[model samples]
Target chain A: MTLWQILILASIACFALKLTGYVIPPALLTRPTPARVANLLTVALLAGLIAVQTLGQGQSLVLDARVPAILAAAGLYALKVPFIVVVAVAALVAAGIRLVT
Target chain B: MTLTPETNGAARASLAVGLATAAYGISFGALATAAGLDVWQTCFMSLVMFTGGSQFALVGVIASGGVAAGPSAIASAALLGSRNVIYALRMSPVVGSGWMKRIAAAHLTIDESVAVSTAQSTPAAQRVGFWLTGLLVFVGWNLTTLVGALIGNLIGDVSAYGLDAAAAAAFLGLLWPRLKHLQAQAVAVVAAVAAALLTPVVAPGLPVIIAAIVAVVFGLTDWLGTRTTSDTEGAPLA
Candidate 1:
């Protein structure tokens, strides 16, 4: 498909995702079962996205700088550094590693 | 009408975060241009997909030669974006009025806006922060994307200068702040490991889905544990 087609399709899909929750009754959202399920689903979805970005590569795994970057990010986060600093540190470290080795 | 402290704070925080996020849109635009998309296409993605992950995924996929690179790239992006739906749900209670407002809210409901808004102590702050962050990011991201795309077209090969790191770094920037809690840390570790393990085996984005499942399971169990104990007090369980 063309770029426009892709954009249109993707846009539609995103809007649909956003709209689905809105259209659902607010009462349904407040219900215990749905609320619990939604919480789980959110966590799961985030995990999946992080995994795919960090790990998956062109339908396969490379496990290069991204791995180390993630580790560094985690470490910085553990140390309680600010978000921007952690990300910059990780990127710098990854870039250094890539430059050196 | 007088503005409460919460509303005032929300407005300020939103502006700060939105502006910060918008600055990164330049990087995205530059990256997209380097990947071979025209300025309009890049802007289109910014306007339509709007989500950073999906936009990056789309550009990456297109750069590598469309679906030949991997169909899962798009799917993975979509999955990653799934979290926003939850954020919107939570936000609906606070900022769910008016058709125009709702549409605008949905567009602005990103991780930064949600976290900042939720972190605020009071309702007014939450409302202010949410809208401010949303509007600022929306405007900033689009403008930056345009600038980056234009610059990228002129610069060529941004990877050589480490431009590629910007997006990943931006993502890390977003994820870092939430690590304050032990649960958040645990979830990050579990998700990262899961992603690493599955990336090589599954489709490009499937690993994310798998990791998400793991996180959901952990979160659910934790929720259940908390709920069971809270029930003892004869209070409504969250």
Candidate 2:
């Protein structure tokens, strides 16, 4: 129930998932439907993950600097400006907003 | 020892991507602390989880505030991490025949390793590339995490740098490249909107899980829509 406990539990679960790939029948991993779901599920997970991290705050949602930061990252990424630049741009923009406000 | 072109490429990728991706770890360290993890916990997650996407998502859940964010965080992290299972399809047979080697490979099998191996021209090179990238990334990610965690402690105030946004943006950049198709874009949009809307009403971690269910719907329907009509002749659902 504590943070460390949650982390420990998550770690165990993650190890299981990775090991499943190694141990599961190859036939199942090769199947198209599961593969399709896994691929899209990754996209979905990213979306959900991004959405919460961008706006979430202590069990609630709020608009904040992450909005413009994320938008800047998305814009730079689309341009292929390079990965580090993308992260730096977002960080600078968000920090700029915080400094001013 | 002599080097081949493929071996050279693997080594180059190991250094380049390994270091680049490893540099990103500073952000994870800063953000993980901003999200309430101690330096030890942050490093521990990187060590045990060892997957970027899942580690970042777990931090997202923690930032949203729940010590018992167990189910949803694990579920989302596990779902994203399952891509390794798919990667395993390409990597499982190629890496090793022996159980010991396979076990080691399983621990190291990740995006960078998988990419480096597949780019190689031979089984020997693939094996070399896989271990090289995997070990480097593992070491680099953890090393940078320590550096960042130490700095984060010194900084003491996470909001000073707006690392929450930085972390979110960094993670978005990671996911952006994979959204190549219309269906993938649709799934991301639907999941985002669902999570955003649900966050206010649901428990901290549950919104993401709910968004995941929404994604499953989109994925299944998309698959069904593309199913060849001939193949579905006997399928009542079609």
Query: lDDT tens digits, residues B34-109, model 2?
Result: 7788999999988888888788888877766556676777777777677777776667777757778777787777
Q: What TM-score does structure 2 among the candidates reach?
A: 0.90
> For residues B1-238, could you state the per-residue lDDT of candidate 1 as single tens digits?
2588667777777766776677668767876887677899889878777877567656654543454434554554566556566667767876867888788788777766777777788877877777777666777888889998988888776444344454444445445544444555666667768766766665544555566665557555663233422100110000
DockQ, computed on Cα atoms, for candidate 1: 0.37
lDDT of 2 by residue, A1-101 (tens): 67787788877777777677778778776755666676677778788888988888866777888798888888888887766677678878888998888
Candidate that scores best on TM-score: 2
Sort candidate 2 into its docking category. medium
- Tell me model 2's lDDT, rounded to 2 decimals: 0.75
Give the CA lDDT, 0 to 100, for residue B157 in model 1: 66
